[model samples]
Target chain A: MIDNPYYSHEFHGDYELVSIGRLDLEEGGSIPDCRLAYTTFGTLNEARDNAVLVTTWFSGTHQIWRDQYIGDGHALDPAKYFVVVVDQIGSGLSTSPHNASGDNAAISMSKFPHVRIGDDVVAQERLLREHLGIETLHAVVGGSMGAQQTYEWAVRFPEKVKRAAPIAGTAQVTPHDVLFSRSLVEAITSDPGFAGGEYTSNAEVVAGLERHARIWAVMGFSTEFWKQEVWRALEFDSKEAFLEGFLQPYFTVMDPNDLICMAWKWQRGDVARHTGGDLDAALGRITARTFVMPISEDMFFPPRDCRAEQERIKNSEFRVVDDVLGHLGLFAVAPTYMPQIDAHLGELLDGPA
Target chain B: MIDNPYYSHEFHGDYELVSIGRLDLEEGGSIPDCRLAYTTFGTLNEARDNAVLVTTWFSGTHQIWRDQYIGDGHALDPAKYFVVVVDQIGSGLSTSPHNASGDNAAISMSKFPHVRIGDDVVAQERLLREHLGIETLHAVVGGSMGAQQTYEWAVRFPEKVKRAAPIAGTAQVTPHDVLFSRSLVEAITSDPGFAGGEYTSNAEVVAGLERHARIWAVMGFSTEFWKQEVWRALEFDSKEAFLEGFLQPYFTVMDPNDLICMAWKWQRGDVARHTGGDLDAALGRITARTFVMPISEDMFFPPRDCRAEQERIKNSEFRVVDDVLGHLGLFAVAPTYMPQIDAHLGELLDGPA
Candidate 1:
């Protein structure tokens, strides 16, 4: 659909891309000839009931789910179920602003159409039904923006997801969360090299990306992380070195325009829009066995906010991962949180809700 | 001293400027012919024993004390005390990178010399003794960066200060504080319009300054403020309007170079530096009857951090101002905090330690 080199459809061993065709957006626009990049492991059972959908976080590809969550004896085990990791639309591997074509050619850079979590779920549904022939998912698991999509899947198509786990994210974005997302977008757009988001290469906006990474460093982890000098764990000489070596390098490769598009969606994350601003009703529509997992120290999406929504969702369980890593605990950085997540996911997947 | 139009020495009614002569910086280098803009209110007593020294916060001038704290019945009552409000050096009205001359002429913009909180106190001390002909201050009061300077005055020149009230600020910049300060500086420097700090006007780098202001909007207030939509109190129609009308306009007039210079000083704010890096020994040097007032909802300088230092200081009391406005409570926005501050200052000035 598109000839852009930035669009990475290359199959890295098992990773594959599926064309979902033209996508009508939640807002008034449409993305023409859209495609979703995804990866799968293990065999779909003969009954077609052993499929789990894994969504990617902001600026993360499907690789994160594969590398972190999917393994023998871990949550989302390939031995038990066929796990599908789908890259969200704005993610570089998907039909992002950097790679969309046909009628969507004008959607490049700053003109990228506004996307919502609902729209992403719509695209993801088509990918599952048309490409993978998956009528229903055994479970849907995600954290952060992925968690936002997981909530959308449960709310938008209730019967499609049997069990849902939304981690370190919420069905609604609070004013504080909106403010944090806005800062990240502002950090990228304020760069003079951004040139109104028409920068030729991501390299031109490295400074803004670095600053964005710095914001993440402060907000992503709890104060105790900095107090304990956890940067030392990363084996960097100092905090500044850790920032340069880890954060800067990690974010610099991301397309700034894609980040902006994702942030817009992140800011407008309330699922209540579907039910006429009735958050309780929107959450009430979920029939899946839901587990709302929030990090105890997460300043952005605290456990209290997550618990509020979890309480509204019928047949839902609220679990807080207690870790000093804050919002980052969802990434399974420290060994302290992985077992908790694994046990919960294992219960959701193997045991009765 | 310096013929920079950016340096407003002309008296704007009550506001006036005083040349403090050449100021040798604490961190090497000298600001040749440094000038400090200040304003005075009420009358000096016959014995000159009623002098109260008030310092400026980051980006604030001498006028903040005049408008907020120095009224007939307010905290720093001009009727009962000779209130001297001195702008911190690097604040727009003072001898900052925007106005410095002589050897410091080349120190314009990013090349501005490093200045610590001790350096600002050193300059303030000279201004009080030489220009105002006041050897001792009945009290030194300030909030935020101003509070940092207040602590420096008590610890560095213990005999000169009789009473000190440092509000919403700590004597040392914690790693958390440093990260915040660093983000603000990086936000400015990352802007293409920054041109390595060689920008001609503030308007040239509005985007960066606006980003910096957005960061403050999130960090300066508590989550409760946003949750309750406190911007309505400021008569704004919406949060977006408040950002555009208040935050943007307020910061746009400020020189970016001056902000960067002040942020550099803010990052290095450790009174421990003066006492061989021993925080307890440095706090122990404070003979001034001190009131360490930290805003209850302030995430930046939490009451715990303030109380820890207060516990180490001799003749000091810790009072947490119970308010939801967070660090902004120090600005006296809500009627709730002003009375507490007024009561504290009244007792500190009138009663024995």
Candidate 2:
């Protein structure tokens, strides 16, 4: 068998953590001796009040945001502000489907602890409180699933968040979102060798992962991207080459167990339920000034889903990204919406509210 | 069990066949007996020469085009042209996965008989010759997969088609199309009880069907559509109600076997291969003055794909539909492109060269 170049390798950080802590989920499960993957790009101020909490999206590790935004004078000006990005549980870096010990690793949607978006936010909050001693965050920012975390942070600990930017994200899963996520889970669970997620090896799980990737590709990008990237536009030395470049990237980059875990988490995300199903009550708790930016072409967290949340939150204002890149327009067509992002971030950072 | 209103007791004139014939699939498999299920409205003129052949899209029985387009002064104009709409093999109205007998039924992708776009055209040609006794057609028109079939008519039997309008469709499946189709197939096959097409009892293909529908929904509409349809502007009573409307439609409206068969046939479609893999050769064979209209947001069949085909054809013009409705826009937003459709169709019906 030929070596596949598309497969991503595991990365262990060079620096060791000073201390590690376990977070007991409300649903009666504990992430025992949880190892948090964290990274910093710039210097922290004397007061540490300029710290911003960056949340990761679905299928994304802490490394993604760190690579993109944690640079000098950028949206996250690491030189001026301390940026702390935490990997959510179920993601590869944190306690996850891959590295969880004993009974935890074998868990799935049915057996897995009921982890709401608030649970993820709570875990990150505990990490911040214990490790970095962050009593308050200057800003909380995220996209997609990350945006759900941003919403949770504002509502769960209103006093902690001064400003919030939830980009191409939603407050709750729409019926369509549930439908999409259900399809993804079904794609994984239906795999013959999945054996209800108790496979001794990873082969069947990877097939499910690949299926998950294809589903994501369709929903993630705009029709424009698919038009250009797939079908008629595909050109290569051979069909094998085309499959390698286009299809393999979906399955090869991520672990199979990770796909199942993230999709399970994604389906259960709810800010209102986190506040005990009182949508109005949750909205009233958010004291932070919120800027909800949903890309017009976003397939996953549609602009209108975000708009519905904008209508609920007290100090929330919404903007629609008109780029053709769909859900990924927040990242891929960043240039088109960068000015808006910069404007919102600048207004909050500079203005004395 | 909930009342599935989607499973209507057949529409008016539904399943009523107007003509019957044999569609000789020259590629080794003979559909010994083929019966076309069609509905016609308005009057046919004295001259049999004023005949229009309307093709149907995948999963869209003959009714959509015949019922919707075959009105007086409409794009099809049944008053002037004697319309002949034949249901393609493996599609609902004709021989298919649901009602198929002998070797044709229960066919999987690997087991499915190789039926190309040319097979559709040839079958329709036989329908026109043996049953209708029409020497020539005024125009051949269809949308999406229908357009694919229409394109086939123009090239397969050049002398038969005087004009052709293949709308909201591509010249061929793009790399993205292949990827999506491959994923859909995997989703169905991965179902444990699928039992490699051997599972006759207690098999749950609904999960696979649901996955296929979700993918189809993602591809059919833009993000704006989901926001409008599923989120902010939804009319459904609950999230479950909305999902039933959004996700269940595919499973309820189409059989799992039918969806797979349609997808398989779609994957096998290659008009370029009909003329020995030389696209120019296929286009060269088309003596019909062709008009190709591709929807702007139709990622499945982008305007560029249509233009490439138009460029190959001897006498062909291309029109671009600027609508966010995506592939479905051809039918959903028909008013915008109808004038162009009418003009091209009228010119073709004038007379044979």
Candidate 3:
């Protein structure tokens, strides 16, 4: 494993591992002895039926969902239901390009294989059924890339999921977004320090990572966020202050190979592949009661795109939530963000399958 | 100039230059022995009162406004008025870092002086009065940075201009746009070939230039443009083709230093400097009849921003033109783009001042 102190469990708290073993990928190839990084909250009853699965977004780990949205009095109260947060493969904490050591060294760094949204669902399904001994999920919830996987869980294994919520993400990626993600991939490879994915450490590729972060700064936040000087809430007096203090430092510590891997997959996230590019047919397979939640000011996945996908799923509700931070609102930057997610999720979890 | 065939008169057609001597700058220092590159259509009448000034946007020369909006049937009819299209300083064709040799070598490459929107207007005014022997302008028309210059012309020399039209631009760039332009700067500087703005040639910094191009691809076009597959109209099969065939080659030929110099000025394009940061006061100085024309889909300078500024101009009308290509519609990518501009300009040019 790459000895990076920044993303250790110390930085994100504790997590456990579950080996699903030699899982095959949707895009051809297999992750030999693949292990999934995850953490659970509350307890699984004797009936093994009160389990909920939470997937992480890009660059996020199992710890993101903890404390912020899974506490008592919240919709995802761990005291009431067993909440399992799974770190998606290639997410650094899992079998990422940064940490594929020992029996997994063959897929390390540049040697890693391509992954799809479907591959993450397949592996997580194994972790739940084989390792944790759960047959059906009470609900599956996530935001951004996690949301892409949420739709996969709903459509691929329709009968197994009781409810699903895919927030700030679309089932089939838009042409605009596919091009947007390409910019991130180009930023990494263009860096000379990348050295064709043979860099000794993340520090070597700091220039490209900083470029990646700056690109995100332009698209992640809503126009209103910058117009109203919302960075003041984040303690930044000027936009330059936010660029230097918050943005540049955030991505500089990340491994570019892993990020490029995610970007490639993110660009290819199409559940419509199941029905040969028929998005309506793919969404029609979703049997679970669902909430298609999109942040109203989100630049990446606008509300109009989310509403179109929501119309395809029979039992789905179109819920538009406010978040001035736009796509980055998935971080719960808005004070109302978590509370709103709780209300929508609480209702779906309590309703019929 | 820099021996760049792409920007030569053979490519852009006929143009001329006029020396305005040593001109003072808005942000301190000066472009010593500065020259303004320009092209004129039709004829200067004996009266010279029918003269109009057309400013070019960033990366544009004196050719863009020709044929598209300055023909016999269009709004800027050369037969009716002497149309002078002037390329702004640091725009490669007009005393930019790339070609700043001979007496202008002191401000060449990395040693180029910082510029503001007001500087261009001041230089253009001197060219009109000292060289061209014109005391007043019938109207001033421009888009993007060109728009920024148009506002400067109206407010700085209120008595000199009879009409002004600032299209797809803002008097003061928003905080969101400031951060967006920073990404472009970062992309170039982060490339190893940039060598701290000391690159041997534009060809050497192709990687950085391509990254610069890709960033533009994401923000230049509107969501509807991508959703509707607008590139198909341009004969590109996909967005990736548009990236490689168009965007990359478009920027890779230009000197990085010149591009960065333009970007710096573009980010700081605030006419509010005239009234100590009071936008209302700066715009209130406009005695010319004006049309604050913003593209309906322009992401960079949205209509709402233009509307806000129009309210401040005593005789200004807010005109929103639809263009699916967004900020890039300044290139006339939308079929309706030039017509809408012609309609608005015709009204302002024909009306009483």
i-RMS for every candidate (Å) is 1.3, 2.8, 1.3
User: DockQ for the candidate 2 complex?
Assistant: 0.36
After superposition, the stretches of candidate 1 with alpha carbons farther than 4 Å from their true spots are: A1-13, A41-43, A46-50, A101-111, A347-351, B1-13, B43-49, B101-112, B347-349
**In terms of TM-score, which candidate is stronger, 2 or 3?**
3
- DockQ (Cα-based) for each candidate: 0.61, 0.36, 0.72
Q: Model 2 over residues B130-214: C-alpha lDDT tens digits?
A: 6667778878888887887888788778888888888887656665566667767777667665556444431356666656666
- Could you tell me every candidate's TM-score relative to the true structure? 0.91, 0.77, 0.97
Query: Which ranking of candidates, highest lDDT first?
Result: 3, 1, 2
The DockQ value obtained for model 3 is 0.72
**Residue-wise lDDT of candidate 3 within B1-353, one digit each (tens)?**
24556656777788887788887887788888888888899899999899999998877777778857788989899899999999988877777877888888788778888988888888998898888888999999999888988988888899999999999988888888887888787778878788877776777788888888888888888877888889888899987788889888888888788888888888888878889999889998999999999988776688878898899999888888888899998888678888888889999998887
* 10 residues in a row with least lDDT, candidate 3 chain A: A1-10
CAPRI-style grade of the A/B interface in model 3:
medium
Best by TM-score: 3
Q: Rate the local accuracy (lDDT) of all candidates.
A: 0.83, 0.66, 0.86
Candidate 1: global Cα-lDDT? 0.83
The residue-by-residue lDDT of candidate 3 on A291-353, one tens digit each, is: 999998888898988888999899989988888889988878778898898888888887887
Give the candidates in order of TM-score, highest first: 3, 1, 2
